[model samples]
Target: MTRSPATPLPPPKARRRLRETAALTQTQLATRVGVTPGIVRAWESGRTTPRGRKREAYARLLKTLAEEEAARQAKQKQQEQQEQQEQQEHQKPDEKQESAPAPVPKLEPESKPEPQSDAKPAPEPEPEPRPESAPVALTPAQAFDALYAFSAPALVRQTFLLTGRREQARESVERAFQAAWERWPEVARDRDPVGWVRATAYEYALSPWQRFRPRHRHPEPPPADPGDRTLLNTLLRLPPRHRRTLVLYDGVGLDLPETAAETEASTPATANRLLHAREAVAGRLPALADPQVLHRRLTELASNERLRAAEPPAVRRGGERRARLRTRAAIAFTVALIGTTALTARTAPTHYEPPVSPGQAVRGVPHRVAPGALSDEELELRQKLRDQMQDGPERLLPRLE
Candidate 1:
């Protein structure tokens, strides 16, 4: 049988006590009690209290904390007054001592008139000061929306640069947003929430997704080539180290020193990796001769990957098969055309086969020799090319064949 979800237990007195003892605000107290502040007000008003044995605990806890806070405030106020009074007394004594001699004692005193009045007794002394806590504030909805917009994209970019993984960047942004929701006041106080999120996202990117996963993979920065659709593809193929180096150097457009700091590598190592990375790219790179083109390509790769994540392993394998088929088809077509052309060139007949002289006549056609064919050089030229024919299927093979 399916178990019905248990009815949530009403807030007990003990929870209220915890809130009271913590001296938390309604919202803060509600958070600790796991109930809304409205519920707290209901309990305090005696309209409803937690039921069962837990009720006793809540009542005792809240009552004790309330009493304690009352006593604490009373004590503190009393102390302040006492200190002020004492200071006055001391000052008065000093002034009197400096101006005149000792106090004069009265020789005789007579009662004048009795005044009727009711005077209250002095209040008790206050307790010691409670440690001060930082103030907590709630964020406005508009503030939260602005924060999310600023932080999300910045985090997304940082995560990409740090882990060379877009998915991780997305997850990092989500986690940061959740964190911001819980402690929005703190986020609001930051000078640059976007920068904070970006930094946090990069830290998140460095963490392993799962304990069992490899730790060796480090993310690279994006490339600079704007027109290059295959920029991301090149990154996907690079070793993790090279990827990280390239990403810091190119994706973020960091200088060598900054790249080294970002990657936690020495400047020399960073410089070396960058050098090799450029060389590697240049070796296979075409369309990358211009710096503008390279920048466009890199930008395109980062933007595209940010939009399209990698396929699942199974789907990727299927795609690989299709790619292989296309490659093979292209190779076979190229080879067939080359071999057929060679055979045709060897078998074709030429007009100069009988070594026709300039202004000579053939059986049915007038022959015009090429310019340098006459002289003793004719024999040399004949040997050099006795037969060469115009291009056509007819020259390729005899009609009988």
Candidate 2:
């Protein structure tokens, strides 16, 4: 018997979208497919692919989800069309009456103009000159400055919401813009330059390392309003991931997919975080159960605080300075490395020298003896001299001899 081919799955993003639309967590899908949640995550993230039976099960599940989503969207579209038709029907009579042509004025006979030779025609006003129609192209620096000006203030406010510290918020926005300026080509070509900067700012603002900084160790003063303070406290209490998801989705008015993409998380995971974040906030302040209310509260909280961003020229100059410092440091390091290498090559030994072998004792060798103890004759002679030393003159004459 021949084996049938395995079923194919959709792309990673689509797979994730399908799972999220079906409201299935990675674990839940993993359980049905007899695999680990990590495996399911990997599949959705495009790190791995399923095969054989698991592939078939996953494919079937996704196919069902896709069909359901399609049907739901179609139904939604049909409902929208019906609403439009109803609106048109209701507007038809008014539109017809408005479209009716105006009544022609009565044709009265005109009287001849009474000629007054002295009456001068009113002086015709000269037309104002029109300005140039073409748009002015911006230099790279000017373009970056414009982007920074347009996005920096609001981004600072948003970063403040992300991180409760005003100083860090401003710093984060400045650093993000600096980075954008450094990569202006890539940023300019991006479909959403604002989004690129916003993502960078959010990442920096929400960085885990920020918590370790001594300056950020202490929380900034809370908003004066009790409601605003409560809302902000609740937001800060949330995990960073959930807080960011909540901010992007509810506070910044991003859709689920956009938030997911920005946060670099799967759609289902993003939804889960958003749900948990909402629950946490709602649990604290029941009044914020509505997303619109939460968004308004977020806006009010951000606006209540005074956060200002650096000037665009200052930011651009700072970026350039940083880039120059890095380049110089790299060059210095390379020069030092090359110098060390050259020195080593120049001073290194040109040839190998044989090592001296250690000496060993011979088996038959004897230790050398000291000079024989004072000779017997020398001792006798010394005794004789001591005995015969009668006269000093004789001793002196013998010494002369």
Highest lDDT among the candidates is held by which one? 2
| Predicted structure 2: lDDT | 0.86
Best by TM-score: 2
TM-scores, all candidates, are: 0.32, 0.59
Residue 47 of model 2, lDDT score: 36
- CA RMSD, predictions in order: 32.2, 19.0
Give the range of the ten consecutive residues with the poorest summed lDDT in model 2.
392-401
Instruction: Please write out the lDDT profile of model 2 over residues 187-258, one tens digit for every residue.
Output: 786657888888888888888898788996576777888887888889989999999999889888989877
lDDT of 1: 0.57
